[model samples]
Target: MYQPRKRGYRKDNATLRWSLPDRVFFACGACHILAYAFLERWGTPGMQALWIRPAAGQTGNHVFVDGGDWVFDYHGYANRPQFLAHVWRGARRRWPGWDATLVPLPRDVLISEQKSRGYDGLWLREPGQFLHDAMPRANAYLDRFRAPAVRTAR
Candidate 1:
């Protein structure tokens, strides 16, 4: 049985190990590659633009996304009900009118059916596709969230 971590646990440990330039470059490059791949699959973004950071002590601290009604888990896909009930209880309260039937990703239908007995989500054939699709929007959101850096002429 998998137990979720307590609420308000720190999902990320921000240590200033990498230089700002390094972090920015790495993030941009990664997002570019992902965006390219995602565009190849879905053509245009069809999912809702939301990012969900996994809880501490859960999977590798990877950021999840609400790809429309489905929660794109790196390991699998979580249905809307499951996502609301377990992962992020506040979502429903936040988006009251956002309602969509939870459907498994086409490729993961079989696996999802099996896992549905125990878990509230399913696995996708390529979960990255979903994540990549959501990246460009997420990147933009992150950019706005991060403060602009000040530079002085040498």
Candidate 2:
């Protein structure tokens, strides 16, 4: 199981390293087949955003997170869920607390991808990057809850 990082994902470990994707194995007298899965961060920006948004809104500050997204898989239409879970697992290994929601993209994105080549991707938005965008908005959002931090800290 992946743990939450107090801060955010480490660039060195954005890829999910787990062998299996998010799965739900069942035992009911029946056949067995690899089933589809949809991985979730379990926890998400809501909690962080919850605490910071209020402060940023009140202070009229900007918020942003800085980092790059790891390309786990693209156009692997058959294994979309597994690919995402893999990235999630990899991310967990690097930053246990970085519970950034690896939520599924809209169904339309998937459907379109299946039709052609879709950009099945993981938006590994580092907390630091978010602060970057938020700063201008006066959102005042940053990974550093106490003393504000610079992007180079990571």
lDDT, candidate 2, 14-44, per-residue tens: 2321111212100110001000011111112
Instruction: Give candidate 1's error at residue 52 in angstroms.
Output: 3.6
Among the numbered candidates, top TM-score falls to 1
Tens digits of per-residue lDDT for model 1, 22-49: 2232232122222232333332245422
lDDT of each: 0.32, 0.23
Taking all chains together, each candidate's TM-score versus the true structure is 0.26, 0.20
Scored by Cα lDDT, where does model 1 land?
Answer: 0.32
